[model samples]
Target chain A: MLEAISDWLQSTWLSHAFISQGLWAWPMSESLHFMGLCLLVGSVGLIDLRMLGMARGISVAALHKLVPFGVGGYLVNVLTGSLFVIGDADQYIFNDAFRVKMLFMLIAGLNVLFFYSSAFQKTKLLGPDDSMPLNVKIMAGVSLTCWIVIISAGRLITFYRP
Target chain B: MEALFIWIETSPLSLWVRGESGWHMAFPIIIVFHALGMGFLVGVALAINGRVLGLAPQVPLGKLRQFLPVAMLALVVNVISGILLLIGYPTKALTNPVFYIKLLCIALALWNLRWFSYSVLTNPIYDHGVLPQKTRQLATASIVLWASAIIAGRLLAYTYNNMMSI
Candidate 1:
């Protein structure tokens, strides 16, 4: 089923442009991807660290404002990452590394949902001296680990390409 | 310079990284760390700079300094990984002007951070009040510098003329 979808997607005009005129496309997407990665890590990661008990003095609510930047970064990455998938469908669709990356991203997304639903309100009200709940700490750890894994797996994609 | 490149490239460490040995795994692992480090360094820097530029006004600038250590840790990771990468392909990086541009941008960004720390962060007024014009300027420059550094670093992969000497 996945192969069929990839085959269909590969035949599209968008995919053709990504492959034929991809000399500049790949690098441009890659650069933007890096930038977006930085943005996401900087804002979201920092807040996660804070929740994990680092930089406790900074108000969690204030740091929450930076989450939008991270969201923006995520948007940029999604667009570029899709272009990559559309451009060389086989390179990612069947690749183990890409699969792992997607898994990590899924885990991250679920973790975010859990955070907002379970811990966001309580955590945001935390004072400098307030102790973080174990669940929030766990969420932060999961977030950091997921992002690091995502990056490592993304890099490994080239090495493990099918 | 050619002789130097050959000497460095032929070194055991470099050979191992470039060769088809188990140690070849080190090359990509180090690159992975490099990317991770870049994300931490640039990401934290952007956060701090964003705050200074009035993105998160409620957060105290002084408190943000706590993350400096984390950023520094990332910088150290990058430097070590960067050196290893250069060792693996000295001819590739050293021969390219983009490499130097990337380094210069990193240097400037670090310098800008230092200036901001000394001038703005240390000032008690900036803790809760508005940031001064000069500090905002430094923050703006820092964002530009780090972005340029990232772009230049990314370009090095495509712009290099030589991959290895040996």
Candidate 2:
């Protein structure tokens, strides 16, 4: 079933565009991906450090504003990442490293959902003197680990290609 | 320089890194670590620069300094990994002008970090207030420098003319 989907996707026009563009497309996408990685990790990682009680002098609300840049970075990655997958579906769909990356991304997504639903309100109420709860700290730790692993695994994809 | 490149290329460590047998994984793993280090270093710099630019005015500049240690740690990782990479393929990088450009950008960015720390982060007014024009200008320059550094580093792969000893 996965192979079928991959085959169909590779046959699509998006894939043709990516292939036809040839040399420039891959490099451009890779460059953008790297930029997005920096932006996402920088902003979101700062927020994570704050939640983990590293920079308690900063108000949580103010640090929260940086999350939008992280989100913007994520969007850029998703768009470029999709183009990559569309361009060469077989390279990703059947690859173990890509599968692991997807798993990590899914877990990271769930962690975000949990953060907003359960912890964001409490975080918003926090003043400079207040410390984040243990649960929030755990979530922040998980987020940092996941992102680091995701990046590592993403790089490993080339090595682990089938 | 050619002799040095040849000597380094034939060294045991470099040979191991370039070897196509059991040690093949070493080079790619080093590259992966390089990317990870770049993410942390550049990312933290961006956050600090953003804060300096008043993106999060409520966060004290001094408090943001806490992230500096982590960024420094990442820089250390990058330096070590980068050296190993250069050892593995000295000719590829040393022969390329882009690599030196990357180094220059990194040096300037680090200098900008120190300058910001001394001039703006330590200032009490920037604790919970807007940064002065001069500090803001430094912050902007820091961002541009780091961005350029990343680009130059990425372009190294494409720009190199020699893959082994010159």
Q: In candidate 1 chain A, where is summed lDDT lowest over 10 consecutive residues?
A: A19-28
lDDT of 2 by residue, B50-131 (tens): 9888786677777778788888899999999999998989999988999999999999999998877677677777777776
Q: Say which candidate scores most in TM-score.
A: 1
In model 2, state the lDDT of residue A54: 78
Identify the candidate with maximal DockQ: 1
Classify candidate 1 by CAPRI docking class: high
The digit string of per-residue lDDT tens for model 2 on A9-75 reads 9999999999899767887788788889999888888788878877767777888888889999999
TM-scores for the candidates: 0.96, 0.94
DockQ of each: 0.84, 0.76
Report the C-alpha lDDT of model 1 over A1-162, residue by residue, as the tens digit: 999999998999999988788457788788889999999998999988988889967878888999999999999999999999998999999999999999999999999999999889888888865668898889999999999999999988888889
For candidate 1, what's the TM-score of chain A, rounded to 2 decimals? Answer: 0.96
